[model samples]
Target: MTEQPPPATRTQAQRTAATQAKVLDATVDALVELGYAGTTTQEVNRRAGVSRGALLHHFPTREALVVAAVSHLVDRRLVELLTRPRTGHEDIEIIVEAFSGPLFDAALELWVAARTDHGLREAMIPLEQRVTDALAAGCADLFGDRYTPAELELTVELARGLAVSRILRTADADRALVTRLLPVWKELLDRHD
Candidate 1:
């Protein structure tokens, strides 16, 4: 056979990031499908298709792995929230709609589990605060002038509540109370503006 060129190599950081993403994404998938108790490192490793050594190298314990996954999921959504192009209006819709996805489902699982699991709660506190801070800053930057600081904070709170209440929805079209309230909130905001 003719001589072939060597394959291009990824940097160590790239390899590390790829492995972490695989693991974290798998963890989120498990959380959404299995809930907190079901999302063990074994399940995560299997879902991620990575060796136990690799998973342990990055995340020593189940709690560490879980918290990291929560952080990863929220950060992924934040990038989408912050980087996407937007028109002059649609701020409320965008903010609320962003929360109505897998991140909300996964985070909801964690929040419920954290209530009694002291270790998980301890690990989750900083992650929750970090996510909140990042979302606050991102909303301020992306939807500036459309809402005052208080309005933005309240809007984010409303969106969070909407996401939480969405669990009560039975059918896809059941329209959780928050889903109905969002349009009214948007209309009121539009009238105010």
Candidate 2:
């Protein structure tokens, strides 16, 4: 009988990275499902299927985990936006939806929590800036002179406001209003070119 070689073992770094990824992904999931107040380290550890020791080894504090998770999420989203197929004349709704969907909801939980938590606010400010920069870069790459910087920024802000309103259940995000505004927004874009 032939002897089987020993099973290939993962390097320590690979194991560490895998653990961090699992924890971060679980953090985003918890944030999405439970919001900031409800997402505890124990909950994240449970969802990640990692031991508390492993979680603490990677992220010593809850704030560290929260911040790192958001950074991870934003980086992933920026990559998705950059790599996604784009039509030259896509509708505003498509862009709005892309910006304000599930990922945004997850981040919104962090933002709402940061409003009162000074440490979280400090951590979130840099993350917010990074996301904003990534979005601006992505918009430029995708649109390519179709809209000016100010116009693109305004569009992003509008989408965010709509998202926040929807999150608060204060706005229905009426499709009719969006439908009516799309043509006008497109016309504005055309005029800017």
Candidate 3:
């Protein structure tokens, strides 16, 4: 026998899900193309092919949409951070590379916006915390029980400071900065290991 179709209610739910996805995709596009401060509700709505009312219905405020975008970016970065093959079978380099790659780019964009845009920073702090926690947890998992919780936290903080410095650098930028910094961090981890 043939199966029955989804109920009309299910179709409506699916449509809502699809629309929400589009809105989020548009938000990211606007973010990349326009940067966070330049992104507007109208632009996002136009790109998303949703009505202003629909955008408002889904996101309510620009602040809400920006926060959603930050959360989305962080979640994707966390997955990449956790799954990266241990580079050189060296967790330190892998960790540094993870920060210095797309995750770094994302943070750089957000940091510039977060500096002058109060609304964006307000939206980003919690998402930042989650990303930090995930990376620290990964470090602990890599180091096993040899590293204490305090040391793990310090390592995470140092990584964050490095990331921020890379984002905020004015000149003399080079990839070696991250690679160089990793050894100092590795030394700390080594003492505990």
Q: How many clashes show up per model?
A: 0, 0, 0
Comparison by TM-score, 2 against 3, better one: 2
Task: Order the numbered candidates by TM-score, best leading.
Answer: 1, 2, 3
Candidate 1 residue-wise lDDT, 18-43, digit = tens: 99999999999999999998999999
Compose the digit string of candidate 3's lDDT tens values, residues 1-193.
9999886665888988788888877887777677766678999988999999888998998878866765666677667766767553545555555566544554567778788878778878887777777777777767666668787677666666676676567436646666566677778677854
Tens-digit lDDT track for model 2 on 26-88? Answer: 999999899998889999989999999999989998888988998887788777766778777
**Cα-based lDDT at residue 108, candidate 1:** 87
On a 0 to 100 scale, what is the lDDT of residue 159 in model 3? 62
**Which is better, 1 or 2, measured by lDDT?**
1
State how far residue 136 of model 3 sits from its true place (Å): 3.6
What CA root-mean-square deviation does each model show from the true structure?
2.3, 2.5, 4.4
Among the numbered candidates, top lDDT falls to 1
- Please report, in order, the local distance difference test score of every candidate based on alpha carbons: 0.85, 0.82, 0.72
TM-score of each: 0.88, 0.87, 0.72
Collision count of model 1: 0
